[model samples]
Structures are given as structure tokens and as C-alpha cells.
Target chain A: MALLEVKDLKVRVEEREILHGLTLTVNEGEIHAIMGPNGSGKSTLSHVIAGKPGYEVTDGQILFKGEDLLEMAPEERAAKGVFLAFQYPVEIPGVTTMNFLRTALNAQRKARGESELMVPDFLKKVREVSKSLNIPQDMLKRGVNVGFSGGEKKRNEVLQMALFEPSLCILDEMDSGLDIDALRIAADGVNALHSPKRAMVVITHYQRLLNYIVPDVVHVMSKGRVVKSGGKELALELEESGYTQFEDAA
Target chain B: MNVAVAKTGSGRAVSDLFASAEGRLPGSPSVIASRREAFETYERLGLPHRRIEEWKYTDLRALVGEVLPLAAAPDAAALKRAADAVKAHAIAGARKLVLVDGVFAADLSDVRALTAEAGFRTLRETLEKDAGLLTTASTDAVIALNAAMATDGVVLSIADGAQLSAPIQIIHIATAASASAFTRSQVVIGKGARATLVESFVAAGAKAYQVNDAVIVTVGDDADVAHIRLMDDAPDAVNVTSHFVTVGANVKLNFFNMTTGAAVSRLQGLITLAGEGSELSANGVNLLQKTEHGDTTLVVDHAVPNCVSREVFRAVIDDRAHSVFQGRIIVRPDAQKTDGKMMTRALLLSDEAEADNKPELEIFADDVSCGHGATSGALDDSLLFYLKARGLPEKQAQALLIQAFVGEAVEQIADDGLREHVIGIAERWLERRS
Candidate 1:
């Protein structure tokens, strides 16, 4: 059985349909990279899977672990081990990053009927995860993503992904606005979270990010659906041929 | 010319109460005369209604209905209740000055210790000796009423160069329900003195009461002070507090107010930068729920050159509550190089909840930099979704966002413990909301 299965997923925003008949499947332990140009519905697919509000699912169904994924709230899906790294992380003033992480982690645990983590243990875990992501301890003390540099924000998202340890991870344009140094650092954090029991769907427009966190399979998305799917070499092929071909082919 | 206007029911009730209570009120002959003059002013102005520009949003005549009679002197049981309330609301390491039923409770206050550091006197005692203390230049009807009917309050005067090690907590506890309490207090900080003052208004088993309180604060040259007011009255109480503050040269005044309780309450501030080089950071938060209505109106007068002022007010309204903020900054004609900025924001949690934000600026100086902004909105959907995606439930997500919204203004408290205490109050409000 697939970890995530989207059957003819059609998502509409207001009067416009953004994801038209998009279908895909991800099995456990596989790292799939979905490469696409802007407005190709890569983000819309991630948002719909995460159950963001305002995107109406006009048709189709999503299954996770053989359960109806679309029927759950975003938090419920998150508790069931689904995570989406936001393309543009929000700046929530007055809530420290450390506090947000603990609240989120505990909420998920509580939802899964697990005991809450002790303060010392939670702090230790956050310190270890953040240190590896090159996030300074002071950054944790500051407001979540407030006044953070672009690279810092991306790294913060990766830090959450590492701590969450979700089964299915969807990274939507995580490499945007990141310098090469920051990109490599964020990619390393994501790579360190890879596990045989985990599945990841990395969405990006450029192949540069694929260099650090290589994928097992690559899918080309154009006109709201996948136009082609192949091995890791497919990313390089798209980089060489450009998305215009895939756009025309679709 | 005095225009003929009919007095409201509440206004007429207050006048009768004043006439009956005048003999027992503490004051000298001249003070009594001043009180009579003040009462005449109130008679002419009547209760402020929607027609008055400053009282546009808050119609005191309608909301107050009929004013309750003055609260009687605290008896033994009332004193015990007030003591329990002080214990519950006291700030650690601060000297407590407790006022029960609008009268200073010497037994409950740290009077001996406070007097050693500053000039301490009850308003009752001060008015008996000093007749001029009863006179007020304010023309507002509510303030005039306070001047006429005030029974007792604190008169604290910090000496020059006095650095107080602990804060002075003034706790006003109402021990009688279905009655009114009118008190006026004053605090004078001399040159180079540093202090923190906390004024808390709470009730001890009291409801459906009325509180008319006023505090006059004077910050001298080079003095640094932080004034924090927490208004947690009874659920059915009506509270009105007027703050008159004057800052001197090179002074740093951090003023913060949090309103969480009361059926209908208004916290109005008239702060003046009277000397050059003074800085004022005035911030407030209004957390109202149910049918509560809270209004925070401030007028910051820049009367000198080279002074700076910043006012940030945040309000979170839930259920059918209404919150209003009116911030006005005035730069005097001769006050050049005055830097003033004001921002007020409101977040509505329910469809029936309402918020009104008005930020006004009157600039007469050509070279001053003055700006004001106001915004009222619901919580951002994208922000909420972002939190939910991270595993917070809908209610918890909303609470976190609401906290963050008001936390911006609560952070203006210079002290960490006070900040935490204010945050705890906000958390409890959120808990009740959920």
C-alpha cells in the first residue's frame, strides 16, 4: 500500500481551478522530488494535502495509510504524521520559536495519545535539532520567524521537520530565496531526517537543491498535473530542456 | 452663557448623593468650597453623552443609568475581604498600599515603611490641611465629579534623588456591591528619582458596583518611572479611570494599562510632555469578552521641544464584546523636533464582536515628525492555517494568535515579573474564552 495516494485530485480556489485532475502516489521510504515551474500547482497540491483552508476540493480523493485524508482537519492530518514545510513561513510576533516548537510537538503527541514530554527533555531535543540546523540558541528565544533572514526562516522550518519526525514530508519551494550556503545547510537538515520508514515529497523549480538532497524518483509537473516521471536523472534532463517542453507537452 | 440642559438620571442621583454625603466627607472649609464649585461644574456639564467629541463612543449617561450611592466605610468583614484580595493580587517585593471602599486602609498598607522613603499621606488627611489640593483645572464632567465626591486615596511624594528598591503597589478593593466608590490619588516623583508604581483595581465579592477613580502623576526632570494599571473589576461593574500625567526634561515614562474585567469601562489618559528631551512609551491592551465594553482613550500633548512619544494599543474582542481605542497626539506650535507616533489595532474573534480604532494627530510644529495609524481586522486565515498545519488545534491556534496580538503591547512593561503577571492575566482570559 502507498503511504500517500492522490486520485484525480482537483482543487479550486474561489472560482478558479488550480489543481486540475492531479494524481500522484508516494510509497514509504522513497524520496520523490516534484519539479515544476511557477503556477504549475505544485504548491496547491501540498496545501490541499495539508488541508489549508479556502482551497475547495472539487473532486477526487486523497488516501494516507489507507484512510480518507481529505476528511481530517489539518491538525488531525499533522497528528497522523503529515507535515508541510510552508513555502513562505509566517512571522508570528510575541510567540518565541522555542515555545511554538514545544506547543506543536506536545499537541501532536497529545493527539496521538502520548504523554507530554518533560521540559528538560523537550529543551534538550530542541537544542540538539536546532544546533545541527545551524540555528543559534538566541534565534529560538526570538519570535517565530519574526525579523529572521530568509535563510534563517527556511532553516527554522527544517528544524521543525527534524523534530516532528513525520512519515510523509512535503517541502514546497523550500530553497527559494536561499543562498548556496544557507541552501546547503537546510538541505543537510532535511537529509539527516531521512529514514527507511519515512517518505518525502520535495517540490522545487530549480535542480540546484537536488544536488544536496538527491531524490529516488523525479516527477515533472506542468499545467496542474504530472507530465512525466522518471529516475533522479529526470531532474537534470528538465534542467537542460527547460519546463517549456513539459508545458507544451501537457 | 449656560445653556439649559436636563440632567440625566445618573447625574441627578450623583448630585443628591454628593449633597447628602458632604458633611462626612474629609476636607477643610476652603476645600468644601472648591468641592461645591466643582459640583456646579458637573451640574452644568451633566453626564457626558454621545454629543461630546471625547465621549462620542462612550455614552456615560446611558451606560451608567442611575449612579449608586457612596460606599459606606469598611467594616470588619469588609476589611477582612479586602485583606484577602490584597494577598491574592499583591506583587512580590513591592510595598502594598491598600484602599478599601474608597478609603485608605492603614492597617492593611505598608505605611510606616513607605513613609520612610517618601512623603506619604492619605488624601483625606491632605485635603484637611491643604485646600488647594481639591482644585483641578480639568473641565471634564467625570473628573469634576471625582473632585467633588472623592473620599480617600494616597498622596505619595518621592523625594529628589530617591531610588526606590521596590515597586509601590496601590491596590483598590471594593468590598461593597450595588454602591459607588470615588477616589483620587496623586504621585509626585522628584528630580532624578526612579520608581515603579502598580495600581490594581479588584473587587472582593462585589458586583454591580460603580468606580470613579483618578490618579495624578508628576515626573520631575531626569526621573525614570514606569506606571502599570491593571483593571480587573467585578463582572458587572462599571469603572472609569482618568490618568493625568506630566513629564519633565530628560524623563523616561513607561505607562501601560490592561483592562480585562468590567461590564462597561473606560480608561482615559491625558499625558503631557511638559519639558524638552522627555520620552514617553505608552502602550495598552484591552481583552474583553461576553457583553463587556472597554474603551481606552488617550491624548498625548507634546508641549515642549525635542521630546518623543510612542503609543501602541491592542484590543482583542470575543463574543459580542466591543472594544474602542482613541489615540490623539498633539504637537504644540512651539514644540519643534517633536517625534510622535501612535498605532492602534483591534482583532475581532467572533462575527458579532466589534472594534473601533481612531488615531488622530494635531500637529502645529512644522519641523516635527508625527504619524498615526489605526487598523481593525479579524485573525488572518493564512496565519491560522499555518499554525494548524503545525498540529495546534483550532481553539489553541486562535488563542495563540490572540495572545501574540496583545503580547506586542504587553511587552512594553519594563519589568519581567510584571510582564509575566500581565501575560498570565491574558492567558486566564483566553482560558475562559475557550
Candidate 2:
């Protein structure tokens, strides 16, 4: 069975249709990169899957682990092991990174009928995870994403993704606004989280990020639909040839 | 030609209250004369209405339709209830000066310990000897009414160059229902003295009561003061508080006010920087729910040069609650090099909830750098979605965002314990909301 199956998904936001019959499928242990030109509806697909508000699902269905994913709330989708790494992580001025992580983790645990992590255990786990990501302890002490550099915000998102350990992860333009070093660090973090039990959808316009994460399959999106799907070589092919052909074909 | 002013029902009630309670009220002949003069001022002004610019957002004449009679002096049972109320609202490690039903409760306060450090006298005692305490030059109707009707309050004087070790908690507890309590207190921090003062309004076995409380604080030169006001009245109570503060040269003042429990309340702060090189950090938070109405109006006056003042106020309105914030920063012509910035933000949780934010700046000094901003908004969709996507339910996510919203202002509290205490109150409010 597929980990995530989107069958002819049509979505509209604010009376304008953004996703026109987009279809995709993901299996466990797979890393799929969705490459597209601007206005390809790549982000719309990710946000729709994550159950973000303001998007109306006009047609089709989303199945997660053989269950209707569209029927669940965003948090429910999260507790069911689905995560979306935001393209532009918001700056929450008063919520500390540590507090946010703890609240999110505990909330998910409780929703899954699991006991909450004790304070000491939670602290130890956070410290270990943050250290591996090279995040300073002081950064975690500060407000979530507030005053964080581009790299730090990306790293923080990756940290959340790692801690949540979802079954399906969606990275939305994670490589944008990052320099080479910062991109490498963020990509490394993503790469380290790959597991046979998890599936990932990496959405980006640039193939430069695929060089680090190394997707198993590449899908080219154009005009709200997947116009092409091929092996990993498709990413390098498109990067070299540009998205003009795909855009024209769609 | 003098036009006759017709008194509203509340105004007439208040006048009759003073007429009936005058004989029983405390103070000597001179004090009585001062009270009569203040009452005349109140008669002239009547209850402030919506037409008054300062009371534009809050109309006392309408909201306070009928004034309750003065609360009787607390009896033995009432005192017992007030004792329990103090335990609930008291900040740990702080010496308490308690007032029950508008009169000082020395037995419940740390009077002996506090007296050892500073001069401690009730307004009842001070008014007996000196009428000057009640003579405030201001024409504000509420202050004048308080001057006319105030029964008992603390009159504390910290000697020059004295440094108190523990924070002072002035706990006002109401123990009667359908009654009013008008109390006025003053604190004089001598030159170079350091103190932390916390004024809390709570209730024990009280409902539908009214509280009109005022406090005057004078910080001497080089003194450092942290004044925190927490109002958690009964669910159906009406509370009005006035803070008159004067900061002297080279003084540091951190002021914070949090209102969570009152059904209808207004906290007005008139802070004046009278001396040079003073810094004032004023922060406030109003967490209102249901049909509650909470307003915080502040006037920060920079009377001298080289003073810096910052005001941050946050209001979170839920259900049909209404929250208003009015902040004005005035820089006098001679107050050059003054840096004053004021920001007020309101978060409306429900469609029916209302928030009014008005920020004004009156600057006569060309060299002064002054700015004011006001913003009213609901929770950010993107921020909320981010939190929800991370596994927080909608309610939990909203709570987190609201906490973060008010946390900016609450963080200005200088002491860690006090800050946490304020946060705890906010958390409990959130819990009740959920």
C-alpha cells in the first residue's frame, strides 16, 4: 500500500483554482522530489496535503496509509505522522524553541494515546537532538524562529522534523534563501533523517537541493499537475535543459 | 450664565452615598472639609461619559449604571474570608499589607516587619492629623470621587537612602456582595531607596461588587522601583483603578499591570518623569473573556530632559469581550533628548470580540524622539497553521499564540519569580478558556 496517494487532487484558494487534478503517490522509504517552474502549484499540493486552511479541495481524494487524509484536521494528520517543513517558517516572538518543541511533541504523543515525556527526559532528548543539528542551547532558549538567521530557521525546522519523526515528510522550498554552507547543513539534516519506515516529498524549484538529498524519483510539476515522472536523472536533465519543455508540454 | 447639569442615576446614587456615610466616614474636621470640597468637584463633573475624550472608550455613566453603597467594615467572618483570599493571591516571599472592605487590616499584614523598615500609617490615621493628603489638584472626576469617598488605605514612607529587601504586596480583598469599596493609598520612596511594590485586587465571597482604588507613588532621586498591579476581582465585579506615579532624577522604574478577572474594569495610569535622566518601562496585559470589558489608559509625561520611556500593552479578547488600550506620550518643550516609544497590540479570538487601540504622542520638544503605534488583529493564520501542523490542536495552538502575544509585555517584569507568577495567572486564564 502507498504511504500517501493523491488521486486527481483539485484545490482552490480564495475562489481561484490553484491545483488542477494533481495526482501523485509515495511509498515508504522513498524520497520523491517534485521539481517545477514558478506557479507550478508545487507548494499548493504540499499545503493541501498538510491540511492548511484557506484551500478548498474541489475534487479528488487524499489517502494516507489507506485512510482518507482529507477527513482529518491538520493536527490529526500530524499525529498520524505527516509533516510539512514550511518554506518560510514563521517567527513566533514569545514562544521559546524548547517550549514549542515540547508542546508539539507532547501534544502529538497525547493524541496518539501515549504518555507525555517527563521534563528531564524531554530536556535530555532535546539537548541531544539540538547538539546533533549544531544548534546552540541559547538558540533553543530564545523565541521560536525569532531573530534567527536564514540558516538557523531552516535548521530549527529540520530539528522539528527530526523530533516528530513522521511517517511522511514534506519539505517545501527548504533550500530557498540559503547560502551554500547553510543549504548543505540543512540538506545534511534532512538526509540524516531518512529511514525505511518514512517517506519524504521534497518540493523545490531548483535542482541544486537534489544534489544533496538525492531523491529516488523525480516528478516535474507544471500548471497544477504532474506533467512528468522519471528516475533521479530527470532532476539533472531538467536542471540542464530548464523547465521550458515541461511547461510547454503541460 | 451657569447651566444646570442633571446628574445621572449613578451620580445621584454616589451623592446620596456620601451624604448618608459622611458621619461614619473617617478623618478629622480639616479632612472632612477636604472631602466636602472634593465631593463638590465630583458633583460638578458627574460620572464621566462617552462624550469625554479621556473616557471615550469607557463610559462610566452607562456601564456603571447604578452605584452600589459603600461596603461595611469587615466583620469577623469577613476577615476570615479575606485571610483565605490573601493566601490565594499573595506573592510568595513578599510582605503583605492587606485591606479588607476598604479598611486596613493590620492583623493580616506584616505591619511589624514593614514598620521596622519604614513609616507605616493608614490613611485613616493620616487623615486625622493632616488634610493635605486628600488635596490632589487634578480635576479628574474619578480621582475626585475617590478623594471624597475613600475610607482607609496604606500611607507608607520609605526613609531616604533606605533599601527594602522584600517586595511590598498591597492586597485589597472585598468580602461583601453588591457593595462598593473606595480606597486610596500612597507610597513615598525616599531618595536613593529601592523597593518593589505589588498592588493586588482580589475578592472573597464577593460578587457584583464595585471597587474604586487609587494609589500614589513618588520615587525619589536615584531610587529604583518596580510597581506591579494585579486585578483579579470577582467575576461580576466592577473595578476602577488609578495610578499616579512620579519618577525623580536618575531613577529606574519598571511598572506592570495585569487584569484578568474583572467583568468591567478600567486601569488609568498617569506617570510623570519629574527629574532628569530617568528611565521608565511600562507594560500591561489584559486577558478578557466572555462579556468582560477591560480598558487600560496611560499618560506618560516626560517633564525633564534625557529621559527614556517605553510602553508596551497587550490585550487578548475572547468571546464577546471588549478590550481597549489608550496610550499617550507627552514630551514637554524643555524635555529635550527624550526618547519615548509606545506600542499597543490587541488579539481578538472571536468574531464578536472587540478591541480598540489608540496611541497618541504630544511632543513639544524638537530634539525628542517619540513614536506611537497601535495594532489590533486576530491570530495569524500562518502562525496558527504552523503550530497546528506541528501537532497542537486548534485550541492549544491558539493558547500558545496568545501566550506568546502577551508574553512580550509580561517579560518586562524584572524579577523572575514575579514574572512567572504573572505567567501563571495567564496560563490559568487560558485553561479556563479551554
DockQ (Cα-based) per candidate? 0.76, 0.84
Per-residue lDDT of model 1, residues B297-405, tens digit only: 9999999999999998999999999898999999999999999999899998899999988888999989999898888889989889989999999999999999889
Clashing pairs in 1: none
lDDT of 2 by residue, A165-204 (tens): 8999999999999999999999998989999999989999
The C-alpha stretches of model 1 lying farther than 4 A from their native spots are: A240-250, B1-4, B8-14
DockQ of 1: 0.76
**Residue A138 CA error for candidate 2 (Å)?**
1.9
lDDT (10s digit) by residue, model 1, range A1-250 = 4999999989899989988898899999999999999999998899999998889999999999999999999999999999999999999988899989999999999999999999999999999998898899999999999999999999999999988889999999989999999999999999899998999999999999999989999999998899999999999998898999999988
- Please give the CA lDDT of all the candidate structures: 0.91, 0.91
For the second chain, the TM-scores of the candidates in order are 0.97, 0.97
Instruction: Report model 1's chain A TM-score.
Output: 0.98
